[model samples]
Target chain A: MWSRSNTISMIFVALATTLVCLYARGWGYTIVQHIGISTDFTDITISAAIILSGGLAMLCGADLPVVLIIGTLGVFVSLTLAQDALVRYLSLAAVLFSIGVYGMVVSRNAVRVLMSIELMLNAVNINLVAFARYVDPNLIRGQLFAIFILTVAAAEAAVGLAIVLAVYRNMSTVDMERFNLLKW
Target chain B: MGENLTALTAWAQNHSETTAFYILAFLAIPFAYGVLLDRRIIRSGFLLIGVFGAISGVFLLLQAQFLAMAQIMIYAVGITLVVVIALMLTNPRLEHDVNPAIPVAKTSGIVVSILLFVTIYLSLRSEIWPLSPSPVKADNVLQIGTGLLTYYSLPFEFASVLLLVALIGAIMLARAEHRPPSQMEERLDAQEDLSSERNDNVVQV
Candidate 1:
């Protein structure tokens, strides 16, 4: 009984690891080097290890979706780390943004979806602050925008959670699949 | 204790910004993954708190001290509230151990996110940013406060107004009755048949 599930999970771990490594190597060497900012092989391997951690977790096991999400973000992070200072910050934001997108798409729970959205907003804030650091250090207008984004994100979360609670009251479950009252 | 504290400060001073940046980003990636990968959704919510904390440290490293503090104060407390709401919404009776996996959505989510990440990364690398030669001053909070009062005064007031609106709107939405007033009236009118339909929405007196 354990062997069957274990075989499938092992296959998933292998696939995720292979996919993440191929992308890191394929992009890590050529395009990243051509750009003239890519780091050494050591860093690339470190990023690959980050992706493999997810693969390991899955082999150790919750399911496939979680592993894929981790792999995708890992690829984004490791590949982006090839660049230097400002670009690294920008790429990290991009990695977080990608994870947020994956979560938004895969999550079946309504609250989880909103949480993914919050992740996406925070990623944007990172970009804004990074730009403030690089582009306009003296005036710091990017920080101002980030602060505004923070305010709006808080407001959005408050309103969104209230809506979720309202939905929960109408229908006892918070599962997105079960929300069929308005479904045509 | 004083000697150890001074030694620690000297050690930190020896490392450059790049070193600090790598350290914090490395510290953060796993927790960010944990936010979505955990089996329990509530657990993921708590994981998000870790992500926020690490990112706030990155903000501090970047010289945006005020943003870092604001991030900690706002997101830490705000996410905890989100987790609490998730707890309230979860039905104890419906908790389960496992599910038959859905593969199609899983594949699509991965595909779309990778495509989007590639697009974002390409755009970021392709463009050349116009970085200023002037270094950021040490007193970031002072600069930010001055800028807020002088340059961004209008938007600052608007954000406060927005927060006020959200506070009132959220309470209104949560307290809102789903069924029409007439259905509610009919339900109240037929007190004899009250036991048939359960009224969870309280009719305010």
Candidate 2:
């Protein structure tokens, strides 16, 4: 039999997060005012909608990929509604980062895990470039940092895949569960 | 005909960028979804290319033309291809969905990941990100090039060195083998040999 208790608990958590996201935008107004950047309240309701949808998806036991796409698009759409381009870009990055986190946690394959890590790095790059565009347009340090991060990410992917390949050769399986040689 | 054309152009002139953003998002998100959730692992590799391409388009929208170009060259083409190749090299044929996580583990993963997202979203909501009043430099490419060669020259060189080392390491890992083929490799090799032999026999007959 399906565990209804866990499902109810998940719904509560999702609802809680939705409420938090809606209220948190207001909490940040004073902080943003200090930095001379004005924040918009237009996207809070949208974010709440998204959180609710995500919770519904979980309750319905929808496919993982569908849930991820919804999460990403929800953030993207909400952020795109913002007046400040920096906030928009940063929100997109945050969403991508969370998706990466999800992928890393759920993936069984080593290559998929590497792909998730790459996604996270790319999200960080998005944040960097957004900052460069908005924060220090004169110097453009953020773009430079983004480039370095990209290079480092490439190197990491290559090395990570190599390690995975090496492991595969030895063990004949890329499943993370089977990679507990060090456990014993 | 001309009236319709003019109206279309007017619409494009007004909303083309937003339209492009929507198009690219439509293309990117689903493919990115495929990259993570597709039961077919190999297909996910291909979907990744679409995701990267769409992301580069977003970079273009952000006016990071140089970064966008680099994204296309580096991530869209280079890294994605490498990932696909790695996927092919490592995975066994007929490998469908492999159930690695138990049901409880999966549910927990979902909870944890959603929580993580909520935490990040709340923090971002609470913080103030600075924004420059002025537009980006006109000659962003030139400025970036100069910055790379001058101020960030050392790190730039280090990245190249790191890439070279990684290339060498990957080659060694993938190619070098003293022992006989493992079971999966043997199965793969056998399939290869059988196909080749079949081709040869057909040619002779």
Candidate 3:
């Protein structure tokens, strides 16, 4: 049951990593050379580790112990390998995103599910900011958009939780299975 | 050492491509994991904080100091706090058989979700994102503030009104039920007791 095949997801993640690395190597050589840092080996290693952990989590099912160990190690290693400031930020963001996903899968509560969604949103925000920083330094619109996204997220959380609370009050238990009020 | 540090900062500032590469790679881990993993609340909360920190770093790297600060203050801090608080309020106890009932509409939901994802992906691929040649110099905070106050003022006010309504609704819903007969009977008994005590005091006076 734990080792059900997930070849497609793994391949997709690997392919994405490869494309990202190739792009970085080809277009970012000048910047890397200028910084005088040798990151090719380190970058590949970090990427591979992330892919492995993510793949394992998906295939073997989301066991908290395995996820925590793999995610923590992946985050630490990636952060250590990251030479650029932006890379550091991205590494941190990615770790959070993974943690959030872990929460979403393992959590049984509706509130926890909402929290996980917030985590995922935050991860996206980090990426947007990082990209904005690199691609357009002067234009801070991406950051502005991220703030807007946050406001929307907040409103969503408030409404969602309110609904959950209402449901809980009606039914003594906060169990999702018991929330079959609308079910025919 | 000072010179080297300056050089490093300058190099970071200039290298957009490298910045993009790292940001994407870093973001990919979470994005992939989020989609694949089963939900876990505390882990998700922690992840949100991490993502927020990363985004703030991105803003700083781009030299959008205001944006970075806002991202940290609002999205990272505000949303995370709200979510965590909501989780506490809901108070989910762990149990083995707490899974959501498998809906008969599962097929429809899956089909719709897949279609939506595909549509979004296709649209994203087809569209050419316009890369601005020159970055805008406007302070984003000031612009956002002004926009909210001026042109977007009506919508802002409406949102505030909506929040007030919701708050009122929550209060009404959460309030304890009062049985009319019980309340009236208790009130009558208290009144009779009070009247008898008052008569006794009057006689003593």
Q: Which one is best on lDDT?
A: 2
Alpha-carbon deviation at B61 in model 3, angstroms: 4.7
Q: Scoring each candidate complex against the real one, what DockQ results?
A: 0.50, 0.43, 0.20
Docking class of 3: incorrect
Clashes of 2: 1
TM-score of each: 0.74, 0.75, 0.54
- Could you tell me which residue pairs clash in candidate 2? A134-B132
lDDT score of residue B112 within candidate 1:
85
Query: Which ten contiguous residues of candidate 1 chain B have the minimum total lDDT?
Result: B92-101
Per-residue alpha-carbon lDDT of candidate 1 for residues B1-205, written as tens digits (9 for 90 to 100): 6996787568668856765876677667677677666666667778888888989998987788999999999997765576556555554224233231234667688668767876887787778888777767888788888978888899999999999999999999888476898998885677536423433322321
> Lowest-lDDT window of 10 residues in candidate 3 chain A?
A1-10
Score residue B78 of candidate 3 by CA lDDT: 73
Residue-by-residue lDDT tens digits, candidate 2, B110-174:
67866776787667667787656998878999999999999889998998998899889878877
lDDT of 1 at B51: 86
Which of the two candidates, 2 or 3, achieves a greater lDDT against the reference? 2
